[model samples]
Target: MNGNVEVVVVGGGYGGVTAANRLARRDGVSVTLVNPRPEFVSRIRLHQLVTGSDDAVEGFGEVLGGDVRLVVDTATRIDAAGRRVSLAGGGTLSYDYLVYAVGSGAADPGVPGVPGAAEFAHWVSDFEGAGRLRSALDTASASASVTVVGSGPTGLETAAELAEAGREVTLVCGRVLGPSLHARVRRPVARRLAELGVTVLEGAGARVTEVTRDAVQLDDGRSLPSAVTVWTAGFRVPDLAARSGLRTDADGRLLTDTTPTSVDDERIVAAGDAAVMPDHPFRMSCQAAVQLGPAAADTIRRRIAGKTPAPVRMFFAGQSLSLGRNEGVTQFSYPNDKVNALSISGRTGAGVKEIACRFTLNKLVSGARKASSRGSHGDSGNRLETPQPEHPTTPHGTRRSA
Candidate 1:
């Protein structure tokens, strides 16, 4: 608090946390993290949360590295040229560098007269929405009809979970299920859906034009009666970046270079769903966010040290989809969007998805611990010459060891 911090990371999602931890571990840097939420919500598990399988929230104190100071406040504006950020709590923070990892929100399709859609359609994209969806599911009758809009992973997962829980589920897809999947993978996925008792409507081009308490109207002049509706069509970035005069895509995502730095200002960096890397913008997924986090941190570290940052290497690790508690699909993709010959599904696939989720959380925790340990040692070394007072350290000391 005495001097200007070296780096300020805005947002507390996967990308923001990773960048903050990595930056704080560097030899000569101070890191401050800003976000409205005090906890990190595991968005990937949101589907499961809606199905009452897992709690989606985790405490920030348990996740953030010791070296990183947490500021629980919304970022209102960015003064990139001045290296300062305005917080909603009437406080301003200045930094030598800034990272923007503010994520995206569910996109609203511009269908006319979609009454009650915003108020009734439940989305699993965020924790609050998921909680509401879960509560509604609990109150829904045993034979209640559940309609899911969108064919992506979230929609499929929600549909399958409801079906597995004994609720009648109908999945409405504008295109074929798993539109991005290869035909070979799509067939098995469809089969799995059938086995789970989920009615799959394909190529319906059914756009939800209106939502009533018990029914939804589609563009094709069809009405589907349902007790609940879940929407997972697409996502849109927050308007913070655009309103701050940063260069953004038509969808309001901050435009960044390959290294994840804002094209308009190198001092401003972005990651997660809020950033669109112009040279090689990949789909907005947790997979990309995890990689982008450390990549952004490295770029900032290099710049602060006056060294040229290395170019980012974008790679598609793979895609994993969960059908429910005991079924899933894992499609491996090559670096050039080529589908791998091998695909996993069913019980084995569920195991794989579970492992992947655990791996992601474990990676975050491990990275944070490493950063915290490094910071503590560095601090101890600095204070070695000034202190002579001795006190017994408690088991839960201020300093944490890996």
Candidate 2:
């Protein structure tokens, strides 16, 4: 171990991995990544995993850069003042800088009367949850009625997949599909859902009051008899930032400026869903994750090299939606959230989405390979040499959103 290592990254998701890999390319900085899991879950494809369309889960070894050291442990607490991180076991990791890339998770709707919801409701956000949902679907009868709550992308994707599988699907959305999308874009989505045999229920403020074994009751006195209910309403950040006394947003997301550094501590940085970048408070998506990861790494590099960091830029070429197999909708949008005139749907849109997914995977793989090559060249000049204690102590009570 060479000591003088400059940065430590928490989490091993899209953003964390990308940032760590980029930082590793710098000659004078060592990057250490801490994550609970050994593999990276392709969260974007989780819907396909749940629908039994795809079973391959990509591993981190295939994507992590060599120069970045992978620590297989959960970050239990962040000691900002001391520039140290306490792991789950009993040791401590000290660093000159830290990046919080812990992601977000589905927000539990505090609806009353929903029985066994926490235990029964299926979500497509993570790998384990997707596996559970897939198993339930396979066991369900052909005539079973599956109710999907939330009209966002995840909900729409889930409904489309089930419908395509020849199952009865009811999409219960408080609003229409792509509520953020323009009316023109929304019309095509509705038509596609209808064509897929998915019953779209809109304006039905179906505030789930309770989730029973066989039905979901809405605030409007209607009971939707469903064999399964999937929730995809909203997301919440991890509570680690708030518990560590760092400034955060109302929903517990770490508050950062355009540079993506923690509001309270310049030594700490954040990205992905866990960060609330004031200048770009866009919705949490893989798109934002991909951009912010590299941006965060660049900022850390600039700071370490005593250079001024550049402002973060927000851009949106378009938004794409997948509707099972080779059918989807792609809507172009401006930087200011304006819906542009270009819209593509059906097979062409699906093709575009497929290309996008492949592009992301390719970038990740390429970055990891570069990182690994750098590590094998006997390069620890930028790497920290401090030997982390074997039995690391995990900080208690840090809540994670996702």
Candidate 3:
């Protein structure tokens, strides 16, 4: 409305990066992205990073907008009243609008016998944890046993990666494997894990009661010999929002409306796993985060222009699971994320999964390039072209974070 509109995006994950890039497109808008690292963490591939298949990181230049200021620092607090963000690196950033996308990290339920076990257990929750797990796996004996807990995509991918690496692997599904998948779609996943030589245990009895240095005690009074225990059970969002007095869900995800604007403040918006859009929430998957990113960005733009932002339109295309480096499975699903009988497996399936990963990186880079030209020449009124799904029926996992 006046001078340059300052927008500060807290977090460098998929949602934050997308929002920053989109905001950079508007004339007279200044975008600053705050993250702990200069490089973007491709969280979807952290499992591959842990197995030495990929590094899972790239410089901001690869995806972030050229005009966007990159602040390599963690956000310690958000002052909504003052419209400033306190950083871990000892500074504060004032903003006209704040986009919160702090994201999540690994969590230990603190079950008995697991007080200081993070140091010992292999974890793939973050880059550092993935690195540690890589080192542990590299030095462990060939005969060492590895147990991966949780039946979510993360746990499934981790167990498959190690098993494909020829390690002795067991996937402990607390209740069932691929709980979100339809029984028909889950069938192929089970078959592939079997082919990979992974031991899959279902039922509550398979739940880990305690994690020791070299073993995981199951609920059924059984101690599994786990030379390396990789915990991919679940994720927990950062508490920065709740602590800042912002409205948040029970899990600490910022509570937002359809437009992803914070329920308590119109000047603040949120996206990614850290945002809980009431009744419209999806799992903490990259598929959902990417859409939320651009949607939240548009919300900020509209608000600044004295207009109401439209509801964020999110469609979950499908589930892409890489069983290993060479083989995988792509279970096609509806836009609602419900699985279908049609699917792809083996090398062909791996190809689709790899494309999904590349599409995300490419989307960010493309978004940045468009933002650069548009900001320089003024608004061209062209809609940003997002990648469409290959099959009209198969939902496309177009973009997002890990």
C-alpha local distance difference test of each model: 0.79, 0.78, 0.82
User: Which tens-of-lDDT digit does each residue in 1-402 have in candidate 3?
Assistant: 688898989998999989888999898898888788768899999999987889999767668766777766678898899998877656677889999989888875453355435655667978888998898888999889999978788888999988988899999998889886667778878998999899999986887777788988888999899988888877888899988999888788999999989999988999799989888878797888899999999999998888889998889778888999887788788887777887788898889999999999999889878776754444222221111224311222322221
Worst 10 residues of 2 by lDDT: 393-402
| Residue 179 alpha-carbon offset, candidate 1, angstroms | 1.0
Model 2: per-residue lDDT, tens digit, 181-208? 7778888889889999998877756567
Residue-wise C-alpha lDDT for candidate 1, range 1-402, written one tens digit per residue: 234347878898999988888887877787878777667899889988887788877766556777776766788898877877777766677778899999876766443346778767888888787898889988988788999988887787788877887789999887678776878888878998899889888775566777777887887888899889888888877788988899898888999888888999988877788999777868888988888899999998888777888777777857888888989999888985567756899899889999999898888888778787874544421100111114211111233212
Evaluated against the true structure, the overall lDDT of model 2 is: 0.78
lDDT, model 1, position 97: 87
In model 1, the worst 10-residue window by lDDT is 380-389
lDDT for position 119 in model 3: 54
Ranking by TM-score: 3, 2, 1
What is candidate 1's local distance difference test score?
A: 0.79
Q: Determine the backbone clash count of candidate 3.
A: 1
Count of backbone collisions in candidate 1:
0
